[model samples]
Target: MTDKIYNVLFLCTGNSARSIIAEALLNRAGKGRFRAYSAGSQPKGEVHPYTLDLLRSLNYDISDARSKSWVEFSADGAPQMDFVFTVCDSAAAESCPIWPGHPITAHWGVPDPAAAEGSESEKRLAFADAHRMLGNRVNAFVSLPLASLDRLTTEGRVREIGRSLSEAG
Candidate 1:
């Protein structure tokens, strides 16, 4: 296996829940092989409480999980991403910055847990569900034979993963 580490960025409108969840999931699940980061088109300036709670309960480090703009990734000297996935419908629909390396992009849109209306328990459940969906997608991503597949094949596979799993809910 090649020693190259893939860099991934997850995008969302808020960067509070779904995108943060995906970042944490991939960083943990795809450790050594992949590094994950998250950003928003319109940042909320802080991660959602439910998102922090869910990730903390799962033992993920939340020290660096602040909500920030995608512009940060597009700026000079920023890490070049190999993949970018939009985890919310709004973010997917909006115009995004031209990434430095022209990363393979896909929409893995999921319901916004922050927008979940109900009791506290119900809100928490929404975050948990987002985590579960993102976890499955990230796992499938890390399992891909990236070094063997051509760019076209890899892009198609990534798109398929988003379509199949994001549509699950």
Candidate 2:
């Protein structure tokens, strides 16, 4: 497994917002050591407009992002996940696919900023806050000492990272 990059999937009830944000943040931060992807158990088929707006403001490519099902990853020849995280409180409780690799999993449990019912400005703020929190956790994850620990990826260290990342979020 030399030079293998970790594949991380972010899951949510709706792939429109939180999962999208986590995907972009982790991919951007990981560069080469991590590969970030996202999907939902129940996809909305379209990303929330605000998700695109905020990501574009950050100079991220939102054009190719769309809501998709977790089943897409359950197929043959699917990219084996090294880690999986549920980014929304709803998804954390929902039934999930049996990821093939048995990759380390965790729950970040970010509230649905999309469900925030209020002024447009308030909704925007909620999205931004979720973005900030997820970004912080991803930063912590990428900086972990994965290279030094012996048989680290196979050990319980992965679970620790997941738990630590979640609590910090």
Candidate of highest TM-score: 1
lDDT of 2: 0.85
| Poorly placed runs, candidate 2 (over 4 Å) | 150-169
> What are the Cα lDDT values of the candidates?
0.92, 0.85
Candidate 1 regions off by >4 Å?
A: none
> Ten residues in a row with the worst lDDT in model 1?
160-169
Task: Estimate TM-scores for all models.
Answer: 0.97, 0.89
What lDDT is obtained when candidate 1 is compared to the true structure? Answer: 0.92
Task: Pull out the clashing pairs in model 1.
Answer: none
lDDT of 1 by residue, 21-121 (tens): 99999999987799999999999999999999999999999999899999999998999999999998889999999898789998888888899999999
Instruction: Please give the TM-score that candidate 1 achieves against the real structure.
Output: 0.97
lDDT of 1 at 127: 92
